[model samples]
Structure formats: structure tokens, C-alpha cells
Target: MNAESPNIGAPQRPVIRQLSEDAANRIAAGEVVERPASAVKELVENALDAGAQRVDVTYADGGKTLIRVADDGCGMTAADLPLALSRHATSKIDGSDLLNIHSFGFRGEALPSLGAVGRLVISSRAEGFEGAQIAVTGGAIAAVRPAALNRGTVVELRDLFHATPARLKFLRTDRAEAQAIADVMRRLAMAAPYVSFTLRDVSGGEAREIFRTDAEQGELFGALAGRLARVLGRDFADNALPIDAEREGLHLTGFAALPTYSRGAAIEQFLFVNTRPVRDKLLIGALRAAYMDVLSRDRHPAAVLYLACAPELVDVNVHPAKAEVRFRDPALARGLIVSALRHALAGAGHRASTTVAGETLGAMRPEGPRVYQMDRPSGGAIRSAYAWQAPIFAEAPAPFAAAPEPAPEAVNYPLGAARAQLHENWIVAQTADGMVIVDQHAAHERLVYERLKRQMAESGVAAQALLIPEIVELSPADAAR
Candidate 1:
């Protein structure tokens, strides 16, 4: 050993001792409860896993001082309260098979981890059982006692990260964290369209509703559409195309937006694996690949896609928070998404998204002030002026008097008939509801490109044999390269 070594006289043998249960739980909290949003995600997911029909979440000061989640879900019994706060205790799965997980939680770490870091209270009343409540502060459990409740469970967590104040330093601003919480709720709501969700913010003794969606009714797609309309807005619901496709054992279902309705950032893309929301790179890559041709590189396609398969085919235990998964056949899943979205987009044909018309109308709105119907000429006065011009129309030249070419018969076509051209580039067409202004060069380029692609698809690649075959012999090692 060097004489100047810092550990020259230190003990040769190290002593190892088991960490206290409370200390161990705090360590686990470091992994499970990173921020307010993470805590919200775990609690909400637990509620959903417990067969919740409706979930209500409220937070204060970005969940630093207060956070509460009440769910109309199957409640736990008094005997289960203490166990639920123990490490590695969960009702979501058996210890036998990890690959076949169907719920959002399995490791049984979220509740205990949360209790270790916050002042946690769970009150509940199960069917055929009396109401009970349990409280834990900084990993110190209190005796279970009778409490008042209704049909489900209410979990209240106050002063989160109170035990480990160091973790609080990593939190973002209150507004940003609240937005993150809302984002989590939105993803879960989208995942389970049939379940209702309400999120509220309670700060400074005032309760403000942030987001709410009632349970949707009807078939899967219909319910999903209604839920989407409520959650993602009517614009998305109207512009999105329905996607239903299957390959091998995987079934893909969701709505994908039209290329014309794409966004500048990848904000609205939501992917789920067997009803569990996931942020997987493989699925995102597949979505981008599907729309690579229709959308520019700077634009991102918006979609909400769900991939369903046998539970055993995908492993959901890949991450601590269950945000990622491992697919038994990643290629198969990727190919299914890519093919389904591409097929849907291809089948949309020449249809323009409603967002385009909305944007056009918005842009055409006048900025000037004060114009009312009463300020304009009366309808009878306009009719009388038209009657005065009738004889002038009758005295017009023969070319002008030939019924004006029947107004170009604007009937079936959405673009109606090409009425005029301007600057040798813009083509103006009349439609039933309104007029369409198109860039002639851009439209022509797109039409030509589509035609070329169609021809290529029809004729296949022209194949011809090489005039002369030139080959070189290689050694065994070089041939492998």
C-alpha cells in the first residue's frame, strides 16, 4: 500500500447490516415517487387496477402539501390495510408469472413507497364490510380504526416528500407539475374510455376543476370516439380517421389524424399496449414511419392507437413505474402499427381535413369593426336593383347571353368547378358551401406524384439482365465480409 493512501489505516473488513424497514421504505420511495406527477400516476393506476368506474383526483401546491384520490373501486378490508402498506405486497398479481401482468401495478411498491415519504391516509368501505381507515406518517403505521365512508375508497396524501425533504428539491414549478398531473390523467382516461375521470386543483382554500370526462356509452369505437371528442377536443375527433386492423395475434384499434391535420410537434400521439398507456420508442418510430411520406419531416402525425394481444405476449414489468414494456415479437407489433396507419391514410384518398376549412374561415374573418345586417342595404332593395338590370342582361351580346355556360355545373365535386385562375398559379373553384383557392403548381405536383406512384405500383419494377456479368473470386475471410 502507498504511504500517502487515504485508506491506509482503515478497517480491512467491512461490516454490513440490514437497513431498518422505515429507512428501506424511504429508499424505495426514491425510486417510486420522484415527483408529484409520479405519485398521481401510481395512485390513479392503482385505482384503475382496483376496478374503478370513476376516479377523482385533487391536488394542492402541485401535490406538495396535499393530494387526494377518491375512486369508486372495490375497497380493501381492515385486515388488508397494514399489508397494503408492506413492501412487496400486492393484489394485482401472483408471484408465479411476471410476464402475464394485466394491471398497471404488480410489484406492490407504490403504496408503501408513498407512505414512507408522505403523511398517507386510506379510508374505505368494502361490500359486506364495515368502513375502516389507516394512516401512515413517514413509514410509521397507525392502528386501523373504524371510519366513515360510502361504497369505495379515498386515499389522501398530505405533505408529500415530508420525510425525505431532499427529494422535494427536484420538483418543478407548481403549474408545470400540475400540468404533468393533468397529462397523466388524460392518458389514463384515453386508455379506459369507459371509465370517468375528474381532476381538480385545490389551492388557497379554493377548488378549481381542471379536467373532467364522464363515462362514454355505446360500442368500443363509438365510446372511444365520444371520449376522444371530450378529451382531445372536437377538432381532433372530426379530423381523425378510424384505424382497425389485425395481424397474426395482435389487434390494433384507434384513430389516426389525417396528414393535413398534422401538428408541428409530437404532442397528441398516444400509444397503449393492452389498455396500459406506454411511451415506447418502437411504437413511436413505427407511427413516424407510417406517415413519413404524407407528412413533412418537421411535422408530426397525431394519433391515439391501442395494440391488444395476449398478456403473455408482452411483458409489462420492464420499468419500475410500468411506463415501458417488452414485446415478445417487437417486429410484429411494429409492422402492424406501420401497416395499419399507412393503409388508413392511403384509403383517405383526396379528402381534405375539416381543420383546413376551419383554418381558412378563421383566416378570412374580418378584423374591421362594427358592421351589422341593419347597416347594409335591404333585401328588397337588392332584388329591385337586380330587376332593373334584367333588361341590360337581355340586351347583352350573344356570347354573354348563352346562359353563362350554366354556371359550370358545380354539383358533385368537392372542389366544384375551376372558375378562374390568378397569377398563372392560383386556381379558384366554386363548391356547394363555399369556394376553394388552390395553388395550381402544388396541386399539379401532388397529382403527378400520386399518378407516378400508382403507375409504379401497377407495373412493378422493370427488370433487365446485366449485359455482362463481372465477378471476382474472394478468399474465405474476405467473402464473409
Candidate 2:
């Protein structure tokens, strides 16, 4: 150590201490409950894990003031209340096996984290046990007391981030936060088609329903289709094609809209891994790759895809919020996504979306009824018209010259035989059942490009030499120059 160093008088030893329970929970809240939407997501997932058939969510002032989630699921008893608020304690999985996680939440930090930053109240009633309620404020827990409740569990959070006032400044406007909450609800609803969901805004003491969907019945695909129609709109359900494909041990199933029904943005894309919604880069990239040849760069494909495999094959603990995941064989998953979507698209042939027909009809509709007036011509006008028809009607126009007719075989061929050329660029051909119009230049260019690509792919565009060389005659002086 140099004597001139300012650290010469500083203590040589450093001390480390454990964080208090309340402080530790508050820190966890910073990760698990970043904002109002985070709280909504955690609570909803818990409800779903409880085997709730229906979930209802209500929020006030973008969840900063209040947020409530109620579900008719198996409620926890009085003894389970305190344990539920303990960090790293969860009923979803055993500590021995972390690889095979089936539930939406397994970290067991959501309840405690919320309690550390806000006033949390949970009221529930089990089937055999009486009703019970527990309250926690700023990481301080109160004793469970008897309360009035029918069945299921109800979690209410009030004054979120009140304990940590500095976090309030990072939140967005009330409307934006509410929109985030709605997005979360939509994703969750799509994942579980059998469950009914409802969302309401309870601001200003007046409750207004923001979204609602009843439980769908029937088989898996049918129920999922009905739920999708209710959530993504009927137009998408009408235009989208059912996708079902399996590779190795992984299976991919869902609906992908036709290329003609693509979106301007990727807002409609939803991906799930074992019923857990995720925004993974590999899956999204593979989806884009599958549609690369059919859609332009500016257009994005719309789809709702679910990839299912053994739970042991994937790791969901990659992120604190469990929004991202890792697969044992990422390449296999990507290939499955790309191949399945491409096959579905190819199976659709050249068919356009049905929604396009509706849009076309709307565009062709008349603005209003049109009126036509008819008047009688006078005798002088009729006489002048007859005078202009003089000269034997111009010798009957030379018997109306006509071109030769095309053969039956030619007409039956695809794209038909060229009947006439218009403006030296368009070909008007007669098909078996209709007339075909082709752009001569554009069609020729595409054909040539495809042929070149095939040739390159087959044998590196095979070199060719001219059999007969052409000679150009020129003056000696010009050739030298």
C-alpha cells in the first residue's frame, strides 16, 4: 500500500449482512411487480393454476389505486394463507423437480412481493372449511379471521407502490396501463379456451365492462376456434387455416391466417409453449421465415400457434417473470414451426382470404341510387339521323373480317392459348371456362427468373459456349481504336 493513497486510513475489512424480510420482499417486488399490469398478470395466473373455470378481473385507476381478481377455484384454507405469502414457497411444483413445471407460476414470489409494496387482502372459503380472510400491509401480516364468502378465492390489492413512492413516477398514464392489463388478459384467455374471462374498469365508483367471453364447449380444436373468434374477431377465424403438425416428439397446432389476410404489424401473432404464452425470438423468426416467400417484407403474418412437448424438454425458469423459455433442442422446435406453417400455407393453394370478398363487395357498393332520364326525339332529329345513315350503310363494312379460331386443346391448356395481344404488352387468351389476361412482359420476366434460380440450384447455372460464333466486320483503324 502506498502511503500517499487516500485509502490508507480506510478500514481494511468489509462487512456483509443479510437483508431484512420486509426489505428483501420489497426488492423482489421490484422484479415481480414492476407496474400495475404485472400485478394483474400474477394474480390471474394464480387463479388459473387453482383450476378456476371462470376468472373475473377488475381494476381502478389503472390498478395504481386498486386491483381485484376473483375466481371460483379451489380456495386455500386459513393455515395456507401465511405460507402463500412466503417467498420461494409454491404448490405448483416440488423442490426436487424444476425441469417439469406445468403451472403458470412456480416462484411463489408474487403474493409476498405485492404485499411488500401495497395493501393485500385475500378472502376465501374452502368446501369443508369455513370462510376466512387475511390482510397484509407493507410486508406486515395480520392474523386470519373468519369472514363471509361463498366459495373460491378473491384477491384485492389497494394502493400499489404506496410503500415505495419512488416507483410511482415510472408508471404510464392510466389508460395505457389499463391497455397493458387487457393485453395480458387476452393472452391468458387464448391459452385456456375452456375458461371464461371478464374484465371491468371500476374507476369513479362506476363499473363498466371492458371485455367478456363465456366458456367455449366441444372438442379441443372446436373450443379453441370459438374462443379465437370471440377474441380475435370473426374475420380472422373465417380466414385462418387450421394448422396441425408433429415432428419428433414436439407437436404444433393452431391457426395461421392466409397470406392475403396478413396484418400490417405483428400485433396478432400469439405463440404458446405447453399452454404458457411466450414471446420467443426463435418461434417468431421461424414464423416469419415460413411466410417469407409468400408475403412481402412490409407485411406480417398473423397466427396463434401452440407448441407442445414433454415438460422436461423445456426450461421455463429462464426469466423471473417466466416470459421467456429455453428448449433442449431449439433447432428442432424452429424447424417444426417453419415446416408446419409452410405446409399449411402451401395446402391453401392460391386461395385468397374470404375477408377479401367482403371488402371487395363493400368497395363495389354504390354510394346511392342513380337516376336516368329519358326524352322523346323530335321529327327533325330522326330525319337528320336517317340522312347520316346514307351511302348503303358504307357497303356493310366489308362483311366483318374475323381471325381464325383457336383449337380445343389450346383453349383447355392452363393460361389458355393467346387469342390476341393488346397494346403490345397484354395477352388476352381464351380458357376452357373463362378469359385469361396476362401481362406479357411481367410474366416473361418472372418465368426467366424462376428458371435461372432453378438452374443455379441444380448445377451452379451450368456454363454454356456458343456453337457458332458471329463475326463483326469493321475497318482496321476502328478495330485498333
lDDT tens string, model 1, 315-418?
88887878888899999999999999999988886455664543333332334577887788898969866776786636543333334455543246655566
Candidate 2 deviation (Cα RMSD): 17.0
Model 2 CA deviation exceeding 4 Å by range: 1-12, 361-481
lDDT of 2: 0.86
Which TM-score value belongs to model 2?
0.76
Clashes of each: 0, 0
Misplaced by over 4 Å in model 1 are 1-3, 6-11, 358-481
